[model samples]
Target: MTLDDLFSAAREAMAKTHSPYSKFPVGAAILTEDGRVFTGANIEVVSFPEGWCAETTALGHYVMGGGGRITDICVTAERLDECTPCGGCRQRLAEFAPPDARVHLTDQAGITKTITMVDLLPLGFKTEILST
Candidate 1:
């Protein structure tokens, strides 16, 4: 699917976020290698660390649904305009998505930007390094 399609899906998913703490509703959509899309919205908890991020939520669903090897990912957040994933999220995404996995960001006003994992997390470490 095109980036526009991904952004649209991510934006729709963002509508379901339950982030009352930060009021930073965010969503994520992951496209599997098989062309299936999985979406998720951020869920916040009273304790910050207990909260779940949109990217992890979506990837977890893909794993539970027997889907792995994500090819691309799109993220949207009104409060996070042009904001990329945090360090933890970048590695989390890298674990499932390939080196070329793409991430899309969008604002509430619909301004969108596309970036690859490499751009978000340069010199990313891979599992292969562990085996070496």
Candidate 2:
């Protein structure tokens, strides 16, 4: 799907968030190399640690549905600046997305900041050590 359409998909997923806990909803759109778009929303749990981020949720689903490479990604929250993925998420994303994958952050004005995985995760540690 196109960028606009992808954003819409993420927004739709955000609407389905069950956030009675913190009310800080997050949405994510994962684009696959096969041109498939998977969207996910943050699902908070009473046990905070059990909660899974929308990005990881989507990525997990993608991984289960047959392995595919990620093309680009977009993360959105009530406030875009506050929506950046955590370090764990950045590494998880780097697992599938290319170093130059575009990571978009949708802002309040509907504008977005385009960044690459390398920029967001410089010197990111992959499984290279484990493989070696």
Candidate 3:
């Protein structure tokens, strides 16, 4: 699928956000190397700081779908343009995505910037090191 298709899925996911406290809806879409797409939206609970990020949720779906190489990721926020993943999410994404994986930062109109996974998390902990 194209980047636009990914963005569209993310946008649709954003519309389903359950951000009652923050009211800041965010969406994420992951494009796997096998041509499958997974989408997720931020979900908040009554307990503060217990909510999951869009990227985290998307990663959950990716994992459940039998995880594979993630080629591209798209993220968008309803309140901000080119909203990026949080620090926690950067590390989480680094665990699955390769250094050269494309991360597309998008707004309502479309993608504003495209950065590599390494660029997004230069100092992220390597899974290989953790596993060894």
Instruction: Judging by lDDT against the true structure, name the best candidate.
Output: 3
Q: Write the per-residue lDDT of candidate 1 for residues 1-132, one digit (tens) a residue.
A: 776777778888889999888898888889887778888888999998699888888888888888866777888787768767767889888877777777777776553677788778877777788997
Model 1: clashing residue pairs?
Answer: none
Clash tally, candidates in order: 0, 0, 0
Clashing residue pairs for model 2: none
Clashes of 1: 0
TM-score of 1: 0.87
Q: Is candidate 2 or candidate 3 better by TM-score?
A: 3
Candidate 3: residue 95 lDDT (0-100): 92
lDDT of 3 by residue, 1-132 (tens): 889999999999999999999999999999999999988999999996799999999999999999899999999999999999999999999999999999999878999899999999999988897776
Query: What do the candidate models score in CA lDDT, each in turn?
Result: 0.80, 0.81, 0.95
RMSD of each: 1.9, 1.6, 0.7
- Candidate 1 stretches with Cα past 4 Å from truth are 109-111
Q: TM-score for each prediction?
A: 0.87, 0.90, 0.98
Off by over 4 Å in 2: 80-82, 109-111
- Candidate 3 error regions (>4 Å): none
Clashes of 2: 0
